[model samples]
Target: MVNLGDLNNDIPFDVLSRLPTKYMPKLKCVSKGWNRLISDPTFMKVQSQKREQLSGFFFQQKYQWCYDDITTISYIPVEKQDAELHKTVFNFLPEHVVVLASCNGLLCCRSCFPFHDSCLYICNPLSNEWLRLKWDEPNKENSFALAFDPCQDPIATPTNFKLIRVKQFETDKEALCFSFEIYSSDKGAWRKSEEICKCNNNLYKNRGIFTEGVLHWLTDGDEVLTFNVENELSWLVSVPIPANEFRSIPESCIGDSDGRLHYILVSEYGLQVWFLEDYFESRWSLKLCKTLEEMEEEHSQFLYNLRERVTQRLAVDMEPWIDPLAFKDGPLFCFTIATFHAHFSILEENLCSKFLTSCTQTSSLLHGKAIHAKFIKGSIPHSLYLQNHILNMYVKCGDLINGHKLFDEMPERNVVSWSAMVSGFTQHRFYNEALSLFVYMLRDGTSRPNEFTFVSVLQACSLHESLALAYQVYAVVLRLGFGSNVFLVNAFLTALMRHGEKEEAFEVFEKCLNKDIVTWNVMLSGYLESSCLELPKFWVQMNNEGVKPDCFTFASVLTGLASLGELNMGLQAHGQIVKSGHGGEICVGNSLVDMYIKSQRLFDGLKEKEEMAVQKKQAEVRPVGTLVQF
Candidate 1:
């Protein structure tokens, strides 16, 4: 057994080149000869030739400014066993850096500022080395892109790259045209490309897919704008959309997977993926067609089992009853609706409806509404199930008027129907209506209010000065023996604090037997609202109890320190933020900026003002939870 590090130049080049890319950087630091061998241009070419599969994908997480934070560059390996590679973070680049493109192992980043002369940087994340390319062009705003192909080039250099920026505006002829400035790494200067292509400037930006030695930008009109980096030519390739439900190109997403161009059509029935089989002939082949139902499991057996369990608990006699004509003015229909409601209680557990509801709630609101209309035109039993989910989707989408209307017209109601209406109202800020509906549901006594119902009701109570109402709900929770439940207790504590009942909130917090991260965060946030001095003690106690803090915890703690002007404490917390890998988080970044600025004002007197300015710029990009004041 021989140590690889101890091996001399007598070793074969094939064996030396077979070592992992990650090891190369560390091995470079081993010895002068080893470093030279690893760093040689010929050795790098050999390594590239031997590499079969892609190592991983390089992606950046947007915070505020485009800075090269260690947390920014992420390497996601295709193999799960190489999960350790995902933890490697590269942060050598300057702040306010936006990743334009990545080819081979090289990444190109530029300043994200609106319209200022900015430099573009090309870097190898594996080596953590960068080369800054000066782009001192005019200050007018331009959309930029990076294109490179190491495999296609006969001769490859580390500096082989093409930076293309398009300045698009209407010409004197009143037709849209593009002016391009191309920068070749080989040429080392910017030059205007003679090829002028007509495109919608307003709709075009740099979301180009690099494949087949070409950078492809799918235009708004389904035309692929192609630019060959090697040949330095620009042309258009028309991508003919299949005449189907998705009438426009916007309904489809263009992607490059494994060096092949792919078009993904998000149709109503399912997702259709087409690969460009022949680019010149404009030939495409259907690669995969996966329907939503096939992708999701049918929850019929689980739903039936859940229904039976609920029916056994609620029914006077523990026996099954089935009737097709149950909904037509009969007690059987009433029983059926009760059973249906039980299944709906665990609606989040139902895979099919949950998937469909998520789709509707997030992006496809119009698509969901159309599907609901189609479901309404179908048979009865299936329609009941569909109606329940549709009701949830409408409520989730902020269509409370329609949600309430649907609830009112239902002949029979269950806990799910009632809870959906109450939750929707609470989410949409219709607090009064949500509270009123909860009371009505309790009075109806048809179904017992679950944890979700109580949580939603408590949330509504917290928003208003309804301290008495919240106490009433708390009493009900105690009567139902759910007062010890951590979730409900947290909601109860939050509600108490919201109504300026800090003393009562503390009482609730002290009684929480199982205090999770949210429990600690909620109590800390409440204390911060009043500038309570007990935050430090609570933070120490949280640590002693072995509770690891998250982004929210740090944000609240940093905010408290910022307000109290505790510079030393804030710095300590900032270190913790970095250690926890939440330094780039939007909320945490805000508090850091505020804390630093305040600390500087007290001692250094704006010495770190430029750094603060960069942070503030980053804060502007990441706007969520940035309410910390100077």
Candidate 2:
């Protein structure tokens, strides 16, 4: 055995003495002295020089940024009026540079090049060591954007950062193409990939955002494209688009939903995002957001600009979203890389809870139309937002089933009071009840349906197909200037189609400016129902617009064609189906047989295909490898 005297000072820990305690018992007998050193709480604690080994020490607050200046005008949610937070300013930033986010217990900051110089530096906050990220080729008139996710795992050998830097060189200045790359400290390398972009669209006037676990940016045609940090891959998808602009500028193009690679597109629409159900697939189906225009039109207040005020008012109720259980368990929750471990009661959640409780209780306690006026009489209680939160919870819980009694008994019924009723019915699937309240809301005509109000009404009408009712809704929808909303147009079209008013449905379909695949499907189905047999031509239109048809589109068209008794066309479609490897899809195959049978093309052919499908399904479920081996 090596003597402890021979050990160097740099290796400070007692490796030999601790070795037996850490890894012995398998080799030989251990004495009580060695056992005590390993088992003694104080010795073990001092031996491992890591900070905060216990989980319940500190709580973290989350902040979101949407603009260019990281220095001035940063907005963070304050848990309380007296709540305080620390800010670490990186003065080492070269002039125009700024920091984006702190991820994985490490800090990431980016410095922009001055006057289109195109040179940029990205750094790790913990190391103070930065990299002069090399562009594939340099350009003087070029511009750059950068992001850093600092979260790291101390227990692991090394940590990971979501490092993405994009450089766009002006073609006029001398560049054939645009290039971007993501960096990984764990692998100690960078990989090259191209974003999903339109080859013939504008690349210079580009916008970028960094959040979750990737760098997200919008393309010319308004597609949301992202570069993944962990897998080093890129992806593109269509997100929800709002009809009207915030200040006539599209708010959909703002940034990534929440940075840790989570898709915030639905949340951006102002929906009550329940659970990120399947965040990995980037599949987000939210409790629909009622946009500002939908709200305005619903209450016959179609001619107003209430989006900003309504948004501000709606935001107050959701503040401080931390879990309440955290308060009793831990001193603080650590949030790194956008994931929280150990729960710290966020001051914000408490604030949000109080806001909800206050909005309702004060209304119960006061009798005037203006609750604000009463608060004005005295200092506005700290409990106002909490009262509003309680009202919202009551509404969501459908406790508003007793709302009529509650409203009559209420000290006052202001806008929020009516809103609570409208929201309550909608949340509880009391659509007719919700609609009745809308009529009542407009009876006196003082209160108007704001953004949140209208979206609920429009969604309620989507499944109910009453053309006259929809047209009336449309008159208001357009009067509120929501004619541009792709989603609402869907509701408008569905109403017409159900009433067999194919002509009117087609009119609105053609007028939509932002046509995604869903829009195309609606139009294609309408054209087919009207026997405008040239359905495939619309696929050309979709292709020309650069919208890719998924397998669902194929299923929709094939079902339509089979219904038309077009055997030759069906045969051609079958060829396309087989070519696209969708021949065996259940809907496609079933529709193919149904089409053939209806067309009287060949009855035997249909039966044989069904048998083959059944055989295939059976084969898929019963593995051949499971059979006994000789």
Candidate 3:
């Protein structure tokens, strides 16, 4: 194999730039030269430009009936090539991010759980490069828009970007008005923009279109709201067509297409597309007009072509109505269709799988249910992998009713499917249910219990304090030749110890050849809790085995020694903790303080307590503007 660095830098640059951005992070390990090449900000920008494409529209739908305002944001890709791109687009971000705005491939996102002051982050999902904005006024509810134009100079290192925050305030006359706060990347701080645009009509807060260094938003009134980022000025232009008298509200939106502004209007008859021919003259020209029948016919043809390529049949029960969302380059238009039951999207099987995994990881029940509904409506064949993922999502999200329902409805079951449900039941404290499912899994004879399956069942037994059930499970484990398996032995030992069968737990521990830190900790904790006199002997044996003690071990030993008023043993444990580098841990410190106090060393205990308090204070006073690189 040839080294990437051995060739000219341009050769490697061209090859690496063409690869997908998701795979770029892993390529850093190829060589130091490759790492440096990929780390360059200029190379990342070029790669982002090549790999990032406007494939979809992300829209938020609000469910008013929910007690808390629940907004479901989803993406619908326009082209087939970008169908799977949405799965990993925002996965690199640390927290759940609500996409506030998008401009030139950079997404302005705010943390879903804004527990801190700096919740806003401007990120390029393609390259996984992000910058957190210093947001001091987190308490104030403000609408934000992003404006990013790539640097024109070839030698420029940093890209220049701007963020516009609009806050609504009440005037002395009790009329609503908006004020502007602008943050520029070059200045690295936020400044108040003197210009303020006042409008009584409620502006669409979430949606903003950025083009030609200007951001636009549609207002309730028949006007277009505009903000120029460079000059920090706000203005309004009259709409091409005013709201009709009969219709109290009109379905209209604004978008940028090929560097020019375009307006779309939906009426009972059909849809009309208008282009802003001249911004200075405020001139408008009708670009395209279509009747409702014509639009439906085109949609039907598109769906028909899609159906031909798909082997599965489409659902015939639901009627979906489409709403045009935005216009892209050429004839590409992004739209969203909603049925009576759920929103519809043509998600590929793998994409559905990824969405289910994300939902499971986040415990997002609502999103999981929506994806399941879409899967059913799309009539995709349920592979065992997808079915297991869906089941796991439901179970992990604590929706056991739906999880069991889906499990029962599944045509086939595998060991993974059984293990997930069993684990879910045990995790949610449904001990009896978990045991019953384990028994049923055995009776079904389709799948056999693996180590993971046994782990959950043993945990359920231990938590339920069912020694008889644990014995039976252990017999099965022995028969399956897993008696020496360290994990199974540990679980077995835990069950025995929890039921006060220390002798049996010790016997199991002695027979196991491979023991990890957890095994030692489990035995040591059980002995300490039961006041077993063999604790000292066991600790010496652990040291003889060359197994290092961690914070938990030191804490347990210190607590036991303190209870018995053994100051010498406690002091020895403290020295071990210090040598092991666990003395600074909060748990270890608390243990040491307790041990010192119980031994009548009042001065030492108070000194340790004061040290802990000072350390915590210093941690709390640390600066918050530290840059976090992903």
Candidate 4:
């Protein structure tokens, strides 16, 4: 047997690069040589090129409420493996982080706190590393776009990244002038560019697309704002389509495919895809055009009652609207249909499993129902995986009645089907039903409970206040080799704490090998909720472990301090909160106010309250059109 050491380094390098990126970290532990090979910049670039094609797209949707608007970023993948890998790409970031833009494998995120100074973070989810940008001018409502091309630099470094911030300024003549402030990782600071572009129409602040060393933003007029990152020049290119054909709200978007710029136009007629055949010559080529009737005929089952639903909303004057989102390398396009309710749909050759999963993830009940109707009519092929997705969609959309009926009618049940139903029941407060389903699943022996199944069942046990059942489930979890799942362990700890089993919960916590921030928060909050005098001791232990506290942790600790009237400790905690950049979190702010008021610092408390009120009013008054609401 020849040792790897005897083989050429290229042999090992080529073999390792073929493995999934998720396993790279573990492979680094094999030896120092392997670690160095994997850590090399060149090796990373090669591996990235060898990796799979563009897996999916991350899109943001804003939901407007009476007081404020909440923006959420969601990922939809084209393949199941990609879904499992990239769905939680941003979960590792702090809560309330809004993704500003993405290029290559990097994401630019901003803190979404209304009152505090905004912070920007550039992170690589695959590598689980992030860097915070120095952004002092948080009050400026400027647009930002990220540009990074892996092929540009052989030796990749942070300096290879560029962030462009566009701020609109008015001249004495009242013309709309936009200035560019660029942040280069190499320079380690932001510099003002002398290039200024004047336009008659406003550019969409958040909708910037970077492709081929050029950053493009769609303008309110019939032009696109193109900025060359290398030359630091700005110009506008006329949209390929006629100006009058565009809608007032601008349903068209610019996307990049195969290193060429493509413009997507959404109109009452249908969707048109135009490619820039020659950027220099300003030549455009019509690649694909589908009429509304053609689209409806092709996706009739999916858009079954879309027109009827829009008619019911009395938007008879308004035609069915489609918003172009993202365009991939091939013919695939991602977009949303608005028929009173927004439904996400992918225009692909076939309604694949990934599309069904996307609908389930977005809770698009109407689309899911249409697909199910197609399944019933034998128009679409039936599979256990697709059926489970539909069931999950109904359950997530709060149609539990339909969800249960579908579950019962399923020709066969798998682990996913059972787990989805169980989670649904628990989520909708049917704890008894969840417990019953768990028992039935075990008795049937068709499938065994996995980590997810245990999590949901444990939650049900805790909410049902059935400690005995929780203990039984815990035993089964351990026997089934799922004793190491952190999520399952967290749920078990919660169950124990809810029943006043503090000592037992502590034991479980200590036994947990991998304690994430969530684990520590659970223990801290549990102690506070129990009014246990050991709260301070537990807090000290958590600090000793060097677990960074988040907004939730700060909120819990401050609440306990307030109840105990520990003003001095509360002050120190408040300083830490600010230092950690969680000062803008509404939960933390509210807790700060509570602590100050409880400690008789009425002036400070009142000041915080007033500031929060002002911020709330600002958010409420902001124009809805400026927001990217679904």
lDDT of 3 by residue, 179-223 (tens): 888888888899898988878877853467887778888887888
Give candidate 4's whole-model lDDT: 0.73
Which ranges in model 4 have alpha carbons more than 4 Å from their true place? 1-350, 614-621, 624-630
What tens digits encode model 4's per-residue C-alpha lDDT throughout 293-331? 676676564445433333233221111233222322221
Question: Considering every candidate listed, which one attains the maximal lDDT?
Answer: 4
Per-candidate TM vs. native?
A: 0.45, 0.35, 0.54, 0.49
For model 1, give the 10-residue run with minimal summed lDDT: 315-324
Best-to-worst order by lDDT is 4, 3, 1, 2
Ranking by TM-score: 3, 4, 1, 2
Scored by TM-score, the top model is 3
Q: Model 3 misses residue 188 by how many Å? A: 32
Structure candidate 1, residue pairs in collision: 64-618, 65-618, 66-96, 66-97, 67-96, 67-97, 326-333
Minimum summed lDDT over a 10-residue window in model 3 is located at 328-337
lDDT of 1: 0.64
Backbone clash count, each prediction separately: 7, 43, 0, 1
